[model samples]
Target chain A: MKTTITILLTVAIMAVGQAAVAEPVKIGMITTLSTKAGYLGEEIRDGFQLAIEQEGGTLGGIPVELLVEDDGRKPEKGIQIAERFRTRDGAKIFTGIVFSNVAMAVVPKLVREDVVYLSANAGPSKLAGDGCSPNYFSVSYQNDNLDEVVGQYVSDAGHKNVYLLAPNYPAGKDHLAGFKRYYDGEIVAEVYTKLGQADYAAEIAAIRAAEPEAVFFFLPGGMGINFLKQYAQAGLNETIPVYGPAFSFDERILGAVGAAALGVKNGSQWTHDLDNPANIQFVEAFRAKYGRTPTLYASQGYDTARLIGSGLAAVGGDLSDLEPFKAALSAADFDSVRGNFAFGANRHPIQDLYIREVVQTEDGTFTNQTLEKVFSNHVDAYAESCPQ
Target chain B: MLFFVEQSLNGLQLGITLFLMSAGLTLVFGIMRVINLAHGSFYMIGAYCGATTMAATGSFLLAIGAALIGAALAGMVVEVLVLRVLYRREHLDQVLATFGLILFCNELTRIIWGRQPLFMDVPPWLGGSIELLPGLIYPIYRLAVIGVGVAVALFLWFLFSRTRLGMQIRAGAENREMIGALGVNIRLLYTLVFGLGAMLAGLAGVMAGPIMAVESGMGEDILILTFVVIVIGGIGSIRGAVVGALLVGVVDTMGRVFLPSLFRIVFSNAYADSVAASLASMAIYLLMAAILIWRPRGLFPAHS
Candidate 1:
């Protein structure tokens, strides 16, 4: 009996040693977790983790290792993390950046290192414009492309005058510019609040004076919540109909503002109520695991993970097959939360933009419902402008 | 002319709210001589409390009341438990300890309220727009805010310039040991002063809740602006906080509104738009820097 037991133990030890030599694929995830930014980062982490778990902890016959590093919402920290991942962690692919500046900083580093970077949430405009690079593929839409729909919706609806407001930063400027692109209506005024400002009284007062037919804005993160709440409080919602991109009216923000977001319209590429097979599965799995409604950020994150999965699979488990892997991702053969989509010439996403109305769910939870569809099979106008 | 009048009102209103925040911070600094970086955390707590209570009870007044009281309670608890031990400690220790409090409180707030923002909204009756000028219609909520802020400032002025407790607070601010020798209960007074400061900070947070996001780190952002107010107004002066806050708010507002048009005359429209946006954003910091260059101690310093 003792001899038999010893033989069995020896066989188990040898099998474990063999497993240690198996090929491993490492994907670096730099996110703003463990901070207020974690609201979105947690969603990103969950989406990636869920995809890996669904694949039974393996991607294309190799065990996957997700190395998550906190960027702390700092652009410099993101680059540092990406450099560390490339040099030390032996990661061949980089993913996840919730803020645009962080993505702006890390995208070049990953490209310089010849490592593929998948932007999960941030939609920096330059990456789809003059700064476009081959190694950088966005699993998300351009920041302005989404906002362009909001401008178009308001302008086409014959709104004569609109007010524009955003935080005083690069993202905010891009947002206002994008809005004016599709919106030919007379812009009454453009007000830029301080970056990360908590109060909007002066801005609110300015909005009051503007008395616009409509208001279009792009103030993501905490800024969005402050603007929306203050706008609702100042009774601007009743005076002028508000329109924005996905960030202003998403599940991530609705809970905080709750009924304050009621009647607010936002343009997005996807919504939880998108009524598609891919989205249904994605939403179901996310809700089941998280016990809450997933935001557009989470949906985009899940698509990015699937994008990485397809690239890995197409290369036949070979991490070194960069050419074949890039081609597979470019072909867009994988499932996405936004349904059928493909990367344009600039490597930015070309997908449908959905106009969602902020409405509470049947379960009394705050969520956005798809009201109308805008910009079907939308290709970013910046693709032509891109010097790539 | 009407726009200027309206802009002045806007500036004054902003100043008053900043005063409410800065008044407490400066008092805590001047009296306690402890740099409480987590002071903003208490403000956030008050805002959250105000928002949650208002949402639950559907009473704006009650929410404000709960916010002030709750903030005071949180402040006193910190004074007794955490800050009391640090009274005789070094500035580095005080700063580090308070920094830890900020992290702990921010996370605690997140755990309680979740990651989403809470909509502490304006009451229905207070949420209508008033036609102040022919073309300019201002929200009645803002007008109410102005009234409240001004009243609070006046009330605070009276409290400090009048009552016996105010006298004791002034004495304490002048010299803790001298006041202690005069048979004053220094410990109780410190807690009371902290509680009062916290209540004022809470008042600002609750008042601003309907106009801003009631979330974790909300106070931290405003805290920086309030620091600018203190630097501009002079520390530990209620009057200075008011003046500084108003100037910062109005200058910031005007810069954002007119800078683009001003730049449009010299630069191309696209360049002016981006450049103006960047400068407008930096205007307040520039003003702060300029003010510091002229008056290193502040416009109205309580101490020489």
Candidate 2:
């Protein structure tokens, strides 16, 4: 009975997928869907899936088959998927990478394969800097670019003393360095917690003692959740205000932290409650389909799918024609939900930044409301750092 | 003072959770001599099932009750099918098998629930935060977790000391053949004990859902800290697990807080900045290394 059921399910799945791909161009979505980062990957897949499905399985007059596969969040596994997509799947273009390590492993191969990699995520500094590849383009900005924005926002807010805190990872180090680059603020304290360290009482106490005017952090995922909740519980609000990147309070974290995220000033490239027809359409469509606010990760994924589709249309889906595809991707001609995003000289998106406020809806669902534009057509520092 | 009291309470609350996880893992290892990496998988399963059941039935108590029972049943099913084979095998074999179980659980979760995180709400009765000290509110649900942990610890202590089944477990731990010779149903005992450990793990999961997001693969994320507790509290000893959990909870909290500032005082500001950052991150692991070096057998080794 089990075997029979399994076979039946497999057959059904194959037929549904094949029917979708029957006429449209086939694009392979090499992503992680069975590990720690799977939730984010799923959100990405949903954003793309909804877009493709709503377009009646056609993109730019081509029936699009997004062949989804899990990389298991392993670098080797990601490389293998890339290989399979190029050799076996005959994939012309690729998108969807959540981890920087996996992106690093796949980029060199994408260069060799001559496949235009429209990176929806994984904005590693190396790709934006000396290691920039002509075949590779990032729809997402550099990781530290957000930190640099945080630097500018806080410094311009006239806060002289700021404490920098992050998990003691390479990303944390880069983020602190990024913030320090633009802000001429006095560093009263800079602390790093272990990755996956949920408890932060001691850190909170230390912050309380040091008494910085402001605190900026770059914690993401569950670590961010842990930090925000604990910081609030420790009564640091009476002492210091917190400021940092927007990812900590993205749509994915809405109900888990509840009202704790209110008043947390964040630097965001795009948010759900932005005042634009494209963003309005994106958020409404996303909400209508998924019954939830689209996270920036999801927004990026949607933009990525649309961007890749545009690039494919530019080249008529022929990856072998490198010059057209490269030029098309470099143009960054897509109605991004983040508003007009165009590629800078380094082939990374140069977009506006907004200071968003976390507001509660009537149903208690949380969404970001853009309060003010922090930076317009902001190009990252790493772009100038890149000679290319 | 109110803030300190609240954070310490929070620390104690977190310690309660670590205790629940450590209790289950220690028992499975101490007597069964099985390295079940899938232990956290059961916890994940419980959280998923409990939250889902609650969402479906709209009964939070029923959801938690079902969570424990569901986890135990799943534990037994796994023991019967896969774990029974690895019982007498080498530790490496057990590790490999359980590691495979972790992967299976992860994939199975993705297949069953898509890739999105499920929102798990605490029943209205248990959801709100409390103020043990003025202006220092702690979540009421977290304090309840501490209560549950204490109750479970007492129940376990009494069961192991007085109950006949507990005596059999003790005997089996000392000599498996002797218990078998005494006409104990050794296979069933193993099955029941595994189930009980799984129930504890599930309880921790069910309680933690509202506090943390219920997503696939969260088991692996927290499994490391649970293991750290098990190692610090000598493996298989409940008391050791409890003490070890407390030490780890406090040290981890303190390290992340204090280490960076201490470094800033002793060294050049920039050098201290980097050094303190790294050291603060590693403080708990450093503490673990120090403890292990001093006491190779752990602070309290249970003699089975």
Judging by DockQ against the true structure, name the best candidate: 1
Q: TM-scores, in order shown?
A: 0.90, 0.87
Q: Candidate 2 residues B96-159, lDDT tens each?
A: 9999999898788878976655667656787555666665565566677889999999999999
Predicted model with the maximum lDDT: 1
Instruction: Give model 2's TM-score versus the native structure.
Output: 0.87
- Candidate 1 residue A333 Cα shift, in angstroms, is 1.5
Predictions: Cα RMSD each: 3.9, 7.9
Model 1, position B97: C-alpha lDDT score: 99
Residues B1-304 of candidate 1 have per-residue lDDT tens digits of 6766766776666767777888898888877888888889878988999998998999999999999999999999999999999999998999999999999998898888887677767788898678887856677877888888878888878888899998998899899999999999999999999999899889988988887777778788878888888888887776678788888888877776678779989987667766887898788899989988999888888788
lDDT (0 to 1) per candidate: 0.83, 0.80
Q: What is the per-residue lDDT of model 2 for residues A1-388, given as tens digits with 9 covering 90 to 100?
A: 9999999999999999977755656677778776756777877888888777767886654567898888877899888888898888778778888878788888866766767787777888888888887877888778777777778889889999998888777878887888898889898877777776655655665676677999999887776766676576555654688887876778777556656666788877888877778788988998899887788888888888888768777877665567887897788777888877899888888988777777888877776778888788988777877776
Which 10-residue span in candidate 1 chain B carries the lowest summed lDDT? Answer: B1-10
DockQ of each: 0.56, 0.27
Q: Model 2, residue A134: what's the lDDT? A: 80
